[model samples]
Target: MAKIYDFNYKYGEQKVVLPPGKYLLECWGAAGGGGCKITDTNLRSKGGYSKGELTLKKETALYIYTGEKGSNYAPTFNGGGKAMMHEGLSNGETLYCNGGGATDIRLIGGSWDNEQGLLSRIIVAGGGGRNNFETKGGDGGGDAGGDGSKADSKGTQTNGGKGQVGLDGSFGKGGSAVSPSSRENYGGGGGGWYGGGSGYNAGGGSGYVLTENSYKPAGYIPTKEYWLENTSMTVGGGIAEENGKAKITLLQGLPFLVISSYTSEQAVFTAGHTEENKLSKIEWFIDDVLKEAFTTDLYLEKTINYTLEDNALHTLKIVVTDINNMTYEKVVTISKSIMPLPTNANLQDISTKLTEIGEGFKNGKTSIINILALKNIDSSLNNTLVELSEKIKALFDSGDASIENLMNQLIQANNTITQLNSKYKYATGTTEVQKFSGKANMYGGKYGNTFDRNINDWIKIDNLGFVPNIFYAEHENVTVNSVFYKCVVFAICNIPIFSNEQDFTIDTSFSKEKLDNVDFRAAGIVCTNNERDVYINQNGVCIPASNNYFNLHYRWHAIKFI
Candidate 1:
C-alpha cells in the first residue's frame, strides 16, 4: 500500500524525514494578488505546477516551502517581491501589489536566503506575477519565466532576473519594479527557481524538476509547458490558485511475511517485503513461546510437533522485521491425529493373578493323573492301548524308512524354494515390463551439433496410468548406404517427472570406414511429465555429403519397468 503526505500553506519552511523508498513529488506555486488601476481592473495569473519522482535513502531530510500569495499592502511570504510606490502623484501615494512566491523542496537545511540557495532545490513550481492596468500578469514557467505585460523581460534557468530597471530576483525572491514617475508605477515579479523580471506588470517565475521525468501541462499563455511520456508522474498545470501546495506519495510498499505452504508437521514460509529493503530479523513462535530467531536468511522450513497430545492442535506464529524497522506477522493453526494409549493396573497385581492361575492349573493336572491311574486297573483298556502303541512303532522301524526319506526330501525342497524367493524379491512388490514403440521424423545429426530439443517434435506415449521406474528408448535411422544407424538412450525419469532436473545417457556407435563424411554429433532424449511424452532434438544438418536424406526416419521404442 502507498502512503501520502501533504504540505499546505504554512508560516515558514517545514521539514520531514522519510524512510528509504520510491516517492512521487508534486508542488504548486502561489498566485499573486490582483492590482487595480483608475477605472480598470487587471487579472492575476495563476501558479504553475511541477512534478517528478525521487528515490530517497533512510532518514533523508527534506525541506518543504509552500508559497504564500501576494497581497496589495502586506509583504508576500516565501520570497515574493514587495510592491513599489508611485512618486510625483499629486493625489496622494499609489501602491501596487507584490508578486507571489514559489513552492519547492530543498535538500540542504536553512531558509532560502540568497541566490546560492537555488543549488539545494530538488523541485520547484513557479508563482504568478502581479497584474497591471487592464494587463493580466503572465503565468508561471516550466523551464523559463513568462515575460511581464509591461516592458520587463522574463527570467530563466541561466539568468534569474532579466529586466534592467526591475529589482532582479534571486533564487527565492521575486524581482521588484522601480516606479520613477507616477505613470511608471509597476508590479514586482514572481519567485521561482529564477525570479521573473518586473515591469508595469511583473513576470511569472520559472518551474524546475531535478529528474527528466518531470511534467508540466500545456497552455499557460506566455509560459510553455513540457511533459515526459510513459512515466508514473502525471500532468501539471496552474492548479494552485491561492497558496502553494506540496504532496509526497510512496510508490513502493513495505515488506510482509507469507506462508507458502503448511502442514501439520512441516511449514515453508518467507519473510519478504519490497525489493528495495532486506529483512533485518525473523522470529518463529509456537503457542506464544519463542522457538527460534533468524537474521541472514528470509526463507525457513520448520518442523513442528503437533502430535504432543492425543489429537492435539498447535499455533504457529511468524514475525518479520525489515531494515526500516517495519514489522509484520502471520499466524496459522495446525493439528495432528494421534492414537490413544491403554491404561493398565500396577505390575505387582498382574504378577499375583498370573501365579494363582498357574497353581490351579497344576493341581488340576495332578488330580487327572490320579484318576487315570485308578482307571488303569481295568486290564482290557490297558492292553488295547499297549497293542496300538506297539503296532505304530513296528511299522516305522520295519520298512517305513522310505516314508521318512520322502518327508526329508519334501523338507529339503521347501528350504530350496524359500532361498530362491528371498533372493528374487522385488522392492516394489511387482515385476511388470511395459513396452511400446512408434515412428517419428527427425533430421540427421551434423558435425559439432548441439542438443537443442523442441516441444513440437515430441511424441506422447500416455495412458500408462503409472510412472515408470526407468525408461529405455531405442531409435533406428533408415538404412544409410544399406547400413543401419542405431542409437540407444536410457533415462531415469525424475519423480513427479515435471521437475527441471532429469538424467539420461545415449550411446551411438559407427565405423569410420563405412561413412567417413557422416558425423555422429549428439542425441537428445526427454520424457515429459504427466503426458509421458518423449522429445528428441531434430535440428541438425544431414550427414554424408552424397546423401540428401535430410528428413531421416526414426523408429522409437519406449520400455517401462513398471
Candidate 2:
C-alpha cells in the first residue's frame, strides 16, 4: 500500500513544501468572464480546463498558478484565465493551460494555446464561442468536449446556445441574447460552467446557476481523494476528510498520434500517451480486428504494409490503456494506389540509355526510325519506361504530376533510350532537294496544285516529312464583320513540299462564306531568294493579313524517288 496526498489551487500562485517519497500532482485552469453589452447586459464565456500528473521527491517546492477569469467589457472581449505549474521557482519547463475568450456577437469561443513543449502530453479544453442573433456560440473546446448551445430563434426571447461539457465534467455554455421589447430593456447574461443567469429587466440570461455558491460549479470533482486521521487540512475551497481510504491519482493528458509517412506499399505511424509512466498497454487494429498488442511501453511505433486491390481507403486504429484502466483511441484513414518500385540501379541504366538516344538524335547519327528498330532490349523495362513517360507527360499536361517523381522517371527513361540507340546506327548521306506537290484546304478556301521543295533527301527516301504546323489567331482589336478585317486569320507554315526553282502554280477557290465579294482572291506562293510569302485579297485588293493574327495549318507530302 502507498500513502497519498492531494493539494488543489485556484486564482494565484501556491507554494507547497513536501516531504520525501513519491507524490502525484494534478491541476486545472480558470474560466473566463462574460462580455459586456450596451444595456447593462453581460455575456461571458467559460475558461478551458486541463489535468496532468507529476512525480516529486522529498523537500520539493511546487509552484502552481490558477488563471483568473476574463474581464467583462463593452469595447473589447475578455479572454479566459490560464493555469500553470512549474518545479522550483524560476519558471523553467513550465506547463500551461490557456483560458477561453469572452463572448461576443461576432467572435467565436476563445482558443487554447497549449504549452509549447507539453502540448503533446497535456489535455486542454477550449472556451465556448459567443452566441448572438445571427450565430450560435462555439462548442466547448477539445477533442471530446461538449457541444456549444444552439441559439433559440423562435421569438424575441431566444435562448443562448449551451456550452460544451468536458471529460472532467467541466461545462461552458453560451448566454441568451433576448431581444428587448423596448429600447430600455437589458440583454441576457453569458453562460458559465454552472449555467447562465437570466437577463435583468429583459436583459440576457445570467450564467447558469449550478450550486448556491457562484465560485464552485457542478462537475468540478477531484480526480483523487486522500484520507488522513487526526489531521486538519484544507483543499481548494473544500475541507479534507478523515476517511480511512486513500486514493492514488493518475494524470491523463491528451493523446498524441501521427502518421509520419505513407505510400502505396506501407504506412509508418507513431502514437503515445502523454503520461508515459501510466501507460500499460498499446493495441493496434485495422478496420476493427486487433492486429497486434504491445504491453511493455506507453509509446507505439509501427509500420504496416498492406495490399491495395481496388485502391479503396483503409483505416488504422490505435488504442492505448493506462494503469488506471483509462483508455485513449485514435483512427486514421489512408488512400493510395499500388505503384511499381524501381531500383536505383535499374533507373540509372534506363537513364544512361535515354541519354545515348538523345545524343544520337542531336548529332544526326540516328533518327527516330533507327532507334525504334532496335531489338533485344528488356521488354518489361521498356514498357515500364514508356508507361511512366506517358503518365508523367499526361500529368504535366493536366497540371497535376508530382515534379520530383516525374523528373526522376524522365531521367531514367532518357538514359534507357540513349542506351537503346547505341545498338543501332543509321547510314548518313547528303540531303538532296526534291520537288513535291500537295493540296491545301481551309474552312472557306482551297489552294490546289501547290508545290514545294524538301531540303532533306531522306524525306523522299523514308517518306517521313509530312509534318504540319497549323494555327489560328483572332484580331479582336479590329472590329469589323468583313472577311478582310474581323474574320479569323488562318496561316500555314513549314510546308516541306516546296520549290525555289520557279513560281509554282496555286489555283485558288473561295466559298461564299469565306468571301462575300466574288473578286476576293489570293496571291499564289511567291518565291524569293531567301524566303516565300503568300497573300490573300478581298475585293481585288491584296490584304497583307498574313502579318496580323491569323490561323495557319501547314502540311506537305514527299514523293520518294526510289
Candidate 3:
C-alpha cells in the first residue's frame, strides 16, 4: 500500500520529512470573503487548484502551508492581505473585504511569510480576490492571476500591480486598498506566487508549478474526468473549499539485490534501487545459515571461515526486503578444499615415479607428453606458471624432450596475458556520467587572494563519491554595492574523473553581466585561470573567485564519468 500524508488548514508552515522516493502533490487554495453586510455568499470567488509530481533525491524536508478563508474583520492567514478601512467608518458600514490566503509546497530552505522563500516554492495554488459592493472578486488560477471585475489589473510572475485606486502587492503578500478623503473603501487582493492587484474589487493570485518532469492538470477546477487522465487515481477529485488543503502520496518500486562477488572467504553485494530509503533490511547467509542482518542499508559485506579440515562446497546467499514487505534474493556457490600433509608413504611413491621415468629414458622408449594435457588445470589460477616451472624442472633434470615444449608454451601464455592487460588498461568507448547540482553562498575577499583568502570566500564540496572533472557554474542576481550583477563561470579539469590526479590542467573562464536600472548590458572580461588556486583535489572540487568585498550566491553543476 502507498503512504499518504494529508494536511488541513494550518496557521503556519509545517514540516514533513519525506523518504527518498517519487510522490504526487495536490494543493487547493482558499476562497475570498464577500463584502460587508452582503448575505449573498455565493458571489465569493473560488480559489485555485494545482496538482503535480515531485521527486526527492534523498530524505528531504517539505514545508507545507494551508490557506485560511478571508473574513471581513481581519486579514486572511498565511499571506493574505487585510481589508482597507477609513478612519471614521466601522466594519458594518464599510464596503471592503479581505482576500483569501494561498496554499503552497516549498522545497529546501523554504520559509513561510518570507519573500526570500519564493525561490524554493515548487507548487502553489492561488487564492481568490476579495469582493466589493459594486463588483465581485476575481477567480484564482491559470498561469497568471485573474483580474478583478472592476480592477482591470492582474498579478504577474514577479509582483502585483495596483488598479485604478489601491496599493500594490509584493511576492506572497496580497494587495490592500488605498486611503482616500472619502468614506468609501476598496477590497483587498489575493495571495500567491505574486499577489494580485488591489482596486474597487481585488484581483486573484497566480498559481505556479516548478518541477523537472510533471503533468499539469487541464482545468482550473480539478474534475474526475481529468484526474483519471492526469494521475493514477480514478476517484476523489475536487477543488478547495473555504479553507485550503494539501495531500502527498508516495510511489514505491520493487526491491532488488545483486551479488557483486563471492568467495570461500568473503562476499560483497549491492542493492539495486533508485529510492534508497525504501529498502528495509538485508540478510546474509552462508550454507543456508543466517550470518548477519542489516537494517535500512544497501551495501553488504561478510566474512566466512571454514572449519578444521573442511573440504566441501559452500553456499553464499543474500536477501533484500523493502518497506512494502517485498523481498528479492541471490545465491552463489564456492568450493573450500585443503591439501593433506605429505607422509613417508607419499615420499616413497614420488621416489618410485622418478626412478621409473629415468628407467624409461634408458630403455630408449621416448614418452612424448603433449603440452595441451596441462590445460585441464584452472586457467584463472595466478600460480599456474610457478606450478608449471616445478614440473619442467623435474623433466629437464631427467633429460626429457617434453621439457623444451613446456618451456615454449609458458612463454606464449605469458605474452597473451601481457597483451590482455594492456588492452584493459586503455579500453574505452562510451560511458554514463554522474551528475550533481547545488547552490553555494560565498563572500568576496581581496583581489588575487590566494593563501590569505577568507574561509567564506570559497567552498569545498566533498563526499561526492567521485571527483568532478567538468563544472558549469553561474552567479546571478548578486547585489554588490547596491548593484545587481550576474556572471557565468565555466571550468574543466583535464584528467580522469574518478582517478587520482598527478598532473591536471584547470581552465576557468568567467563572463560578467551588469544590470543598471533593469537595462541589461553584457561586458566581456577574461579572468586568469591559475592552476595553483583552482584544481581538482582527491576529496572533491573546490570553487573560488576573485571578487572584492562582494557577497554572492552561485549555482553549480558537476559531472563525472561513471
Candidate 4:
C-alpha cells in the first residue's frame, strides 16, 4: 500500500524526501482578504487548488511553499491576498498554483491563473474583488471550488461570512464586520488546503474601547474537509504527521477539453490529461445525442471533428473517465451558420458563360444593348429571352405602318433577332427572293399616232430578275389635235431610274393613218411618203410620232446591270 502525506500552514517552506515510487502531489494556493472601510467590518477571501501525479526516484527532494492569507488592513492599507505551491528546491522547475486577490473598497475580485508545470495541468480559481462603501455587500469568489458570501449593509450589526464549498470543491469565504452593540467583530477566515473555514463574530473579548468582559474580535480559525474516501488524508489549518513523516494526499484534477477550431460546417475539439495511463475513456455528445466514444489509455491528447448543421444552435458535452474510476465532464454551446464560400466549379461555370457573352457581343453577332435590356428586365437569362420574344410580338401587333415607324421597328427587330441567333448559334445566311413577270399596254391615242391604246397603263414587279430587285413600268403620252402617241419603258433593279442605263428597252413602229389627195398632187408632196420621226428619252424608251396615218408595233428587252 502507498503511504499518504499532508501539509497545511500560514506561511513556510518544508522539504520532503521520497523513495522510488508512484505518488500523487496535491496543492492549494492561498487567497487574499477583503479590504475594509473606515466603519465597515473587514472580510476574508479564498484561494485556488492544483493537483497532479508523478513518479519519484530514490533520494528525491521536493520543496513546498504554502501561501499566506490577506491582512485586514495593515499589509498595504486594505491590500490583496496570495496562494500556496510546491517547487523543486534544487532546480526550481516544478508545479505552481496561484491564489485569489484580496478585495478593497470598490476594487475588483482577484483573478485565477492557469497552473504551471511540465504537463501544464492545473487550473487556479481567483478570489472576488471588494465592493465600494455605497454598495451593500462584497462580491463572491470564483466557482473553481467554493463561492464567497456577500456582506450585509442594513442595520447596525455586521453580516456573516460566505460559505466555502463551491461546485468543484471547497475554498475560502469573505470576512464579516463588527456589530454596533459594543461587541467585538472578527474578519472571515482564509481557505485551507482541503476545505475553507467560516468567519467568526464572538462576544466577551476586550480590544478597542476596552470594557471588562465586553464584546471583542476573535482570532481566525482554519477549516478543512475530506474530499476522498478510504484514504488517510487531512486538510485545513495545522500540519498533520503520519508514521513520523508528513502525510499529504492530492486529489485528481479534471481533464481539459478545448475547442481548437470551429466553423459553420465543422468544429474540432481536443482533450488532454496530465498523468499517463490515468484516463479510461472519452465520450462526446451533441444535443444530448451520443456522437462518438473513445476507449483508450490515460494522458489523452486527441482531437475530434464534428460536422454541424447550418444556422442552428448546438450543445457539446465531453465526458472523460480515468483508470481510478474518477470522471470529469465539460460542456460547450455553439451556433453555426452557412458560410458563403464559392467553389472552383461554380466560378468556372460563371466564367464560361461570361466569356461566351463577351465574344458574341464583340463579333457583332449579338446585340449587347438589347441583351442588357433583357437582362435588366429579368434576372434569369432564359426567362429574359422569353419575355423579349413576347414584347416583340406585341410591338408588331400594334399595326403602325408609317415608314419612319416601320424602319425603327425593322432596326429593333434586327437587333433582337441577331441577339437571339447568336445565343442559339443559328444559321441565317441564306437569302430568298420572289420574282414578278407581267405585261402592261400603253395607249397611243394619247399621243399623235392615231392609236387606240391608253397612256396611263403601268405595271410593277417586286423582287424581280436574277437579283430579284424592284421594277416599275413607266409611259409618256402626247396628243396633237385628236392624234395620240405614247412611249413605254420599265425601270429595273431599283425604283429610281438613272439616265444612260439600259435597264430595259422598248421599240415601237408606226404606219400612216391617212393621206391628203391635194398634198399628193402637189409638186413637192409625194403620195407614197410614210416616214415618221422617232425620239429616245433619258429612261431608254423609243417614241414614234407623225402626222401621217400609221399603225404601231412594240417590243421590250430586259437588260441586267451586273
User: Could you estimate the TM-score for every candidate?
Assistant: 0.41, 0.26, 0.44, 0.23
Best by lDDT: 3
Q: Residue 562 deviation, candidate 4, in Å?
A: 98
lDDT of 4 at 166: 13
- The superposed Cα distance between candidate 3 and the true structure at residue 36, in angstroms, equals 4.3
Residues 1-562 of candidate 1 have per-residue lDDT tens digits of 5788999988687898876556788888877655555333225565678887776533367889888876765547766676776557666644446777888887665666533345667778877777665566755666766677644455566566554456876666688777776666677777887777766677778887764543322321111122212222211245424888899888754556656666656677766655545678888876668878887656454433333342233456788777777677766544343111113422233233223323322332111011111113235433442343244334534655333443343344334444433333222221122223322222222233334333332223433333444544344444657554555445344434433434333333332224457765443443322222333222211111111133433333333333
lDDT of 3 by residue, 1-562 (tens): 7789999988888789875556788877777655554456556666777777765534567789887866765778766667766556655463437777878887533447765455557677777777776456775654566678655445555567465367666677678777565576666777776677766678877766663233333222321221211422111121323887789888655566655554446556777554547678888776567877788435544333434224343445678788787677765544343121123333233334333333333443233222222223334432453354456445644775563454464555455455443333211121112222322322122233323222234434555444555655555554345555555555555544333423322223232334334555554322222344444545665555333334444566666543
Alpha carbon deviation, residue 457, candidate 2 (Å): 37
Candidate RMSDs in Å, in order, are 31.4, 23.1, 23.8, 37.6
Ranking by lDDT: 3, 1, 2, 4
Off by over 4 Å in 1: 37-43, 73-75, 86-96, 114-116, 150-152, 212-236, 239-241, 254-562
Q: Give me the displacement of residue 284 in model 4, in angstroms.
A: 1.9
Which digits, one per residue and each the tens of the lDDT, describe model 2 over residues 337-447? 312223333444545544443443233211121122122346756575656545644554475545354446557666656555443222222222233332222121123
Output the TM-score of candidate 3: 0.44
**lDDT (10s digit) by residue, model 4, range 1-562:** 3356665542333556654335555444334333333243333222333333443322245544343444333221111211111223345322111112221110012221111210111112122222222221122222222322322211110122232211111222222232233232223333221122222210000001111221222331111111112212111111111001123443343444555554444556655544545567788777668988888533435566677653343556678766666566655544343221233323233334334433432332211222223222213443544454345335434643233433344345445544543433211111111122322232232344432222221121223213312222222323344333333333333324444332332323222223322221111111100112111222332222211222222233333332
Runs of candidate 3 exceeding 4 Å displacement: 36-40, 72-75, 86-96, 109-111, 150-152, 158-161, 212-241, 253-562
Give the per-residue Cα lDDT of candidate 1 at 384: 40
